[model samples]
Target: MNRKTFLKTSALASAGILSRPFITYANASKYRVALIGCGWWGTNILREAVASGVVEVVALCDVHEAQIDTCAKELNTWCTDKPKKFKDFRDCIKNAKPDLVINATPDHWHALIAIHALNNGCHVFLEKPIAHTLKEGTAIQKAARANNRICIVDFHRRYSPHNVSGMEFLKSGKVGRIQEVRAFVNYSGNGGKQKPSEPKPADMDWDMYCGPAKLIDYHSGIHPRAWRRQREFANGTLGDWAPHWFDQILWWTEEKAPKKIFSTSTKKIHDNIQTVPENQLVTYEFEDFICFWEHSINNTRPVQQGENVGAYFHGTEGTFHMGWHGGWTFYPHGKNATTIHEDPQLDLPDGQNIKLVWADFLNSIKTGELPHADIEHGRQATNMSLLGMLSNDLGRSIIWDHEKDMVTGDAEANKLLTRDYRGEWVYPS
Candidate 1:
């Protein structure tokens, strides 16, 4: 950011203190929160964030009436005063004056909405894959730094105690010198087009639903539900859940960005669109180990013996397999079941991890500290996911210059690393 922009933003931030009212101000109300996009994953966020009791749901915004009604009813029951409602997030932010804005919106809206919330002096809780691409993710990192707000990305697996323990095992070299780490995420849903449902409700603004993406038709079924199939709407399953597994991968390695990645996917429906592969197998080269990701939208489980849609740390000692859940098991490196640790009854305060994640953010707000999975953490993780996306697109292995943040072999893939803002939307700071 330029000096002038920094001074202007700092001045504006300082001047915002004068506008606090006894009713809607930050001090009187306990962390008023506005939620944008009430979809499937969004409901999870709404329930968890509301249930956290550290904040109040002051505003609700969704493009669809049914979802809006459903989430609002759930939140209204939890909130003391009726939470304000708006179809557009802009109006919601302007009127409600929330202390925090939680974005469960699609990938495309992540950067724009989160930055806006930060610029408005609201702490932001953003869902993963920080933005659609690397460029936007970097922009968001700068925004978090300049705005100095507690911006936490929802990589909840990172806050899981089991996952943390698993990482500790890797760090301890219990698995010996790590040679390879294989991860898998094969699912049945989240690919292909959906059967057309009835027409969308008249109350819906399909244009706004499209957002920065090029405009198309208004299929109610496609508007919010199967929108994941479209590149403009979602980043498919990779963006959908790779962050969960990647959390384990990155956390275990304690590595930021990998050196290179090459990927291939199932035959695509449209070659022009930047759609994530339905069945992509990405080989990412790291400093110490080679990480293989088996991502598909078809199989329920792994296809190969060494690959079961989980994190596998293959070292000189032994192998460990950990999927989405905390249930992780380890076997002695070369020997058979002589040394295995699988604690089915193990329950080591997973809820405490969640509490710690939020309490850390709240404490960060109080003491200018960066919360767990802060913006840069989100950027690095999201960068890994985007590399997979790019690898799938190119159908070939690609080298990366991490410091400069680009793929060396393909100019075309580099195009997706960043994006031009559609309209007046600017990255904060």
Candidate 2:
């Protein structure tokens, strides 16, 4: 859709008192928060949000009531107040009227729920990858801007202590100027093969779960975890894991969109897999530096830091290695590498990094400052993944015009930037 059409559609959709009157904190210390998607990761985020004592999780929404009930039971132990539950996000938004909405839904549902929350005068804390496609990410950003709501894309790594320290160290001129960046995500499985389709469970609203994506028969592989393999539902490893490292890279380099990107991928390991790449390599060119990303489902080679997944930034004076699990090392140009700050050495335990991110989101709302992973930053990271996938599909480098938000002179590549929403869901345009 054109810019004019997009603005018109979104403006019309956001009509109502909910869109007109933004939520005002009004000097209150506690804000009402609603948690959406009671999945494995969502529950973790919810726990952190509640534990922080920053907000009360007043409402819960999930397509699976069983999951919501189980999570609500868990929440009661930590929070004295019982949270209202709903199977439908619309009902939760309409009735609860929360001040904040924490969205941990799958990639396809992100744009819809976030846009709805923004229109309903709620700040949003959306999980990473931002959206299933670039256009959807843009729309969510647009809604947040239009409604004057805070929408934080939780690319939690930006809040990592090691990364924060690394940024400070780099800015202190210890690493000189970074010229090249390399990121990796190598694992053992062949992405995950499709399982036999089966009937939906009685307690699960399968259609609601499949919102904004083509409805498919319930399958063992598609639920609980394996949805990353579906092209329609996800962007595979690129969308699942790339956002974290890519966002970190952008943060470290102080860069936005790449000037050009090229990628190649293969499903050589598992032909039976429906979608996603078994192995892929992508290269991104910027004005001053270049970045490389690689992912392999079959390869188990250890990275420089003796890990399978992480990122490395090569600079003129020294090289910095950042492990996804949280740690950083400095390899001087002519000397051996030294572990600058080990994550375990910090003694903060496993889950505190995520909590820090949650704290930052609440703090942002209070201070009126942008969170580290604000919507535009999230959009940039997500767009990098989307553009790389488009390059892989096109088998050529696609020049980008960030100012125009398009693939320069490549109509075919540009066409893949946005996707058609499924069912009753319509693109803002």
Candidate 3:
């Protein structure tokens, strides 16, 4: 089929408008799939893949035995065959010989697993922010290119229908020349005091879980779900949520990376619950405009009235708010100009957009075309967040040379581009 026809068919399939499955192969063979890091979101991606009816999961890998068991039980209910389980990803990849590998590990493990899978001739579906650090992200991109493998980063907003329409509206100049962009998230229910570290659970292989990252004491607050708040394991809220918003801004502006970035962060909660900052403000400078990122852990008030977590496009003609589940709205500059609003077709249970993203990945694998959020795009978005975090850590603004992929004239800042891996877990080149 042609490009337009393919896109239309894919969209229709994603929206459940088509009567048949999104993919139908003439032969009986199905794509062999393996899932590493059987955590909450990882399993969610696996679910979409199984639901697609185009792939068979052959292996499940996780450092935690409980997680593997739980995921296996769910897969048993969804599929006819039981998948082999492994604690080591290398064994899973070698033994399962999967055509596609779904990587849902923490940010720290992203680079290692993705590069390994790509090198072993597997198309990778990697969860975002592409890696724990800037260099790691770049390495994953290189691995994909060098191996000539398909790599799709889980930046699901790129596939959202309302987001697609919003981009079309922005490109049409309805919002006029954009001057500044703001991305923010303000919510409650985090920050108080740190939870006490507990003895490691028997079901979890803590050493394997901390591969490549510093091995820290096991805390319930830092595992299973709350790892995002810990600096050792992940990049906190900015690293977790900013990739999606930064991705939206980059997609809308068609820019690769910001020229200069400055940020300030504060840990107001003064708790062990989270080592990362609770409040952060990052400013990114481009040639024509500026982009700002702000997030707060316990502030429930919306950034702009009803919108809690999303981006705002400030233009000469008007302002646009691209919300998560709240939808999109546009306000014109003139005194009597009527505001335009579009309600979101909510992706119930969250991560529903993964289905559409999965369809795109499958299509790309079949057509030999790049997926919607390719590894390069994922690297760019991941770098933006990493740059901001580096600036906040250094307590100053830093210039970035995107072409060279380095921080300009800042020795200390540049040194942080790639961190030293713990023990034998080598950092990807």
Candidate 4:
């Protein structure tokens, strides 16, 4: 459907309070967007948003000077006014007055940065693994609801046209009822190189990067780039990639959160759960089927996941492997399969989601229309990812009560839901 059609449909689907004529008139052009936490992914988001030509860069903020300067250089390359930059995000939003904030901060800082942005009236685009803790996720959700803002979590896979196609295939009922779901995220490490013992660069603000996470000395193994391996600052292997799967599976399976979870995991011998997991497996149970997923920090190979990481929906009718970005095929029961075509027709129009996602938020600011990955969506995915982490820590199965948002009969595991925030941090009511 075209933009007008979509807006009409969305408006029609929206509720009475949100359907005010003024709300429809609120989505004027010239949107002001800001980027928070200028890192690899954050930079990518900035580049995509800039490439859109629809949004203007009003402000930018990052704790690290190196990142700040690098982004400023790129921003100046195109934007004449040169965006306002700051080390502290609070001051940046307060002063620059952006209408939207793209949060590419570390996972640990996601909830804090996103909540603050929404509370300040800036819509948010938070990168995945929505929060380091369940309470943080819940708090962010509440903040969005209370603040009446739009929040989209940065889940790359879910934005792709292939994801939409994948969901279409599964829900078409051609596959029948899904039976079991299994996924593998193996990146061989040779063991991945150990962190280097390099001196910290003068421009890097290590403390701000480690916000909310326990402070530790700057080490090569767990600094700047390799932080994904660490437990506190980052969500381990499961949280790292599970969002890709959760974003796909839940939408494909037409489900929300899993009913129960159990996992067996530990750091690869020399690695720290604080650093890396040698091998970890998390099994999630839904009402009808179970999802068994594996994480390997040591192996790297192409497309075992198919099309830059994909999934297979096992249905009673047959097995369908969908590589939405690359290709897709179905294996029939008791019949020979044709030589699989590596290149499927994936030549799609330039992905509009980067803009549509932004447009949705801009519209939401005026209209209160939640973007695709709103706070509730973020909370659900965050809860699922954190659940996998707890299953790893508990090393066994735990029942999850969606209503209570807790693990029943497992008090130890339940404690993982919330953590102490910084003394100055104030949560939403």
Q: TM-score winner among the candidates?
A: 3
Q: What is the TM-score of each candidate against the true structure?
A: 0.83, 0.88, 0.95, 0.85
Give candidate 3 misplaced runs (Cα > 4 Å): 1-6, 17-29
Q: Model 4, 330-364: lDDT tens per residue?
A: 66455674433233322123332344444455455
Report, for every candidate in turn, its global Cα lDDT versus the true structure: 0.69, 0.78, 0.86, 0.68
lDDT of 2: 0.78
User: How big is the RMSD of model 1?
Assistant: 8.2
Residue range 1-429, candidate 2, lDDT tens digits: 233432343233223112112223223428888999988778878776776555767898998888898888777666565679999999999999899999998888898899999999999999988988888888898999999888988776665556666666766788888889998888877545545677777999998888878877787677768887788788989889898889888877766889989999874657444577878899999988999999887877854355677788888887777775557777777656554655522213344356656766776787676776799999999999998888988889999998888889988887888777777888753
Give the lDDT ranking, best first.
3, 2, 1, 4
Superposed on all Cα atoms, model 3 deviates from the true structure by an RMSD in Å of 2.5
**Per-residue lDDT of candidate 3, residues 290-344 (tens digit):** 9999998767665456578899999988999988777788988989999998877
TM-score of 4: 0.85
The true-versus-predicted C-alpha distance at residue 251 of model 4, in Å, is 0.9
> C-alpha displacement of 211 in model 4, angstroms?
1.9
Each prediction's RMSD to truth:
8.2, 8.6, 2.5, 6.3
TM-score-better candidate, 3 vs 4: 3
Report the Cα lDDT for candidate 4. 0.68
What TM-score number comes out for model 3? 0.95
